[model samples]
Target: MAQLTSIHRFPVKSCRGESVGSAVVEPWGLAGDRRWMVVDDAGAGITAREVNRLVLVHPEITDGGLRITAPDLPALEVPTPDPARQVPVAIWSSTLTAAAAGAEADAWISKALGVAARLVHLDDPTRRPTSPAFSEPGDLVSFADGYPVLLTTEESLAALNDVVLASADTGRDPLPMTRFRPNVVVSGVEPWAEDDWRRIRIGDAVFRAVKGCARCVLTTIDPDSAVREKEPIRSLAKIRRWDGATWFGINLVPDTYDVTIRVGDEFEVLEAVAPGSGPLRPAP
Candidate 1:
């Protein structure tokens, strides 16, 4: 009887996310989720480590198109266009051809961050390859790390905060869920119940919880403005590290089909689809 209270999609990875009233669940990941990324001249990915200012960039899908605004510059606009010039880029293990959003986007990012960067679209069918672990013969993905959606529970965060508060020396501010950047934030569940949920139904959409999401420096960086803090990372390091990798959130495998998910949708836990067999530790 747990309900899905919120849904979010980060069109661009590691940047601010858009709180959607509804969205489509596709095999490649949430439709339009992580469909764009900021990269340097070599086509390597960029993150808060390379440029802290990247955290300052906030993006929202506007009626005109995708609008990117920062603290210092005017909003940069990217119109939804036919896939532009194809460019080569790598997202994790997948080497794919992404649509190049071109020089205007490049100039804006470069000027704002004082670094060479450009915007690339994750729409190329030929270059993008689906994860071998989950692809059906010839599936393709835009820019998701692996799965279609990343799920987290508010109860889990509350539990982690409780741990932080119980310890006297941490001196950390409890963070908003934004720091974790989850696609689905569920409430009313036992802390970490998602770790073992095999099939989860939210609204009309159903997702198969697959694996625990490995955490990275991105978790430590504030998504809104790319500010880095020690308490969260340090605290997570103390409690959530597993198998040499720090992790947060659960990665999900959607039943390869089009599922409509909207805001304010209700979720029903039909069964205990999967159960966590791994050790519970704080992400390091």
Candidate 2:
């Protein structure tokens, strides 16, 4: 039996994630995760990739709503209202019509990052629908990377750590799982066993394994400080490249949109499908 050891939600894209005891699972993903994003004045999305400073911005839920703090500006609070203003935006390849969350959020971000920007909330009803491959009649999502939860087994990280340690120069410390930023980390499993999980029941919530998550530079970004390192990325590239991209974690489809997940939730692994049958590894 597999057990859940941690739960995390990134309130904003590419920023620091909050370690939570429990979280509500919506169709798109965890209720408060990645619902709002900072975008330029022309409605173009911004992320830690382009603005490394975004890594310094941290968001926390407050009694009023969401409070955000960055190194360069005072904290700004925005109420969790279905904002009156709406706009069209793009997240990855999907085009979405979302709500412009708060002008105050924009002001704070603009001042801190020294760029003209706005906060856009993902509110498209059509986009809320889940992928046809995993959707039943009523599947709904809030906002996630592409699924409900991302699962990565500790064994996989251990396996990768071995590669990281072997490849690193003498002084660097071994990488932590935070580098991958999975929502769920399962223990007592074989290396990469999560790749074959058909269904996993954590407490009352059941998550279906949908696909393999393709990794990116975000995996190399240090979550705590937003600093980038080269050893692990180079190591992972040598060992785990898939389809020309290095990848980790398994994308998930929850049994229901209303399920809530918490840390210490016991997981019952129902079945293991074929392992090592997904995307190709990147050439080193």
Candidate 3:
């Protein structure tokens, strides 16, 4: 049986995440995951894609709200913003109202990134639904690109590393799972076994696999030095490239909320979606 080996969540979007022993599965996503984001003057989301240094800002979820710590910068604690102070923000094709985290947070984050930025929180995740093409009715997501959660398997990484070592032009250093920023890391699965999974259950919570997550340049950035390289993407381009984008982890939407998923939780493959078939029903 496959077991969850690790769990992580980003309290703020596009920044480094915090590893957690267990996390509550919410309707939108892991509770407190990507509920906050940094926005530009136009209120459009800004990510590490343009400001790689943002990864250096580590955020920890606190009882008061969020505390962010970064190199050469003082830690800043921010409380949740008032719902009435919402500002219009756009994330990809989806646009919604988000509450601004106030001028202090804006100043702190702006200085950290060396760009004009404002911190905003999704006061209501339900305001946006997962793409109808890939999700069921009422399936909601947080500030995550498209899905509530992302799942990756250890075997796939090993397999990719093997390919990387074999390729002459690609750097052979093994890539850490952090490159993908998966919420749940599983073990005991064959390489890329999740590509066909339609539904799975971990602990008491069930989840539906919606689609494969497409890779981006962010994966090429070294989380430690913030240096961008060409290995994983260069190697993945040769293996998983299609439609102009490389593919990696699978995106998942929870079937049940309020359940806590812990590391070491055994997972069951409830259903597998056949090629050309629609969503598969979970086994009874």
Candidate 4:
């Protein structure tokens, strides 16, 4: 059995996350995770994929609302928009309405990203259903990439780093799991063992593995320095590459609500596919 070693919560999308001891799992995701996001002047989503410096934006969930701080900027406290003034926002291919964070947050985030941007919150997360291909009818997600949560194991990271360190041209020392930005980090598993997991339980909540998370160049960016490198992505291509993309963590959708998943919780596989060939499978 694997153990849940860490639980990370990203209050605002594309920003630095906070490691928590425990959190309530809502149907869409962890209660304060990805509920807010930065958008362009046109209401399209903006992420660190384009502006690596966005990772330097640190957002923390406070009892009343959100407090955001950046490298040289003073901390700003933002209250949840009262009465939820709705505005149209586009995330990926999905179009939805969210609460606008007003001109204050917009101006602050705009300066942080060095672009014209606005901040918005998913006051009603139920408005966005997850992808039809990988999710059930009622499966919902926040401003996350797709699924409700992303799961990764330490064993897999260690194995991937081993191969990364062995590469002659690899410039990185070793990649940390933070680069993957997983919501739950599990320990005590063989490398790539999660490839066969179809369903899993972490404490009181059950989750169905929607799909293996296809990593992109965004993973190559350092969260601290915002520097972009090619080794992790380049090395990931060598071993985890298949299906025309490099694979990393597993995206999961929770089957239970109101369950608080804590650090050091028991993680068990409830179902699995037959061990076989796939992009997420272990290299032979």
Residue-wise lDDT of candidate 1 within 111-179, one digit each (tens)? 877899988877643356556664345555557677668888888898878766767474657778887
Tens digits of lDDT, candidate 4, 208-249: 887899999889999989999886888889988888889998
Model 4 worst lDDT run, 10 consecutive residues? 275-284
lDDT value, candidate 1, whole model: 0.73
Estimate TM-scores for all models: 0.88, 0.89, 0.94, 0.96
Q: Can you list the residue pairs that collide in candidate 2?
A: 27-140, 27-141, 28-141, 28-142, 241-281, 241-282, 242-280, 242-281, 242-282, 243-280
Q: What are the per-residue Cα lDDT tens digits for candidate 2 across 1-284?
A: 56788888887776777888888876667777777778887677888777767778888877656788988578888776574577877665566677887777788888776788777766544466555554456555545656657888888888988888777668667788777777878787788776667777888887777667878776767766777867466877887786677778888777756878788778887766566555322111
Error of 4 at 140 (Å): 0.2
- lDDT value, candidate 3, whole model: 0.88
Q: Model 2 off-target regions past 4 Å?
A: 123-126, 130-140, 279-284
The 10-residue segment with the lowest total lDDT in model 1: 275-284
Clashes of 3: 0
Which TM-score value belongs to model 4? 0.96
RMSD of each: 3.6, 3.6, 2.6, 2.6
Q: Residue 273 in candidate 2 has what lDDT?
A: 55
Each candidate's clash count: 14, 10, 0, 0
The CA lDDT at 260 in model 2 is 81
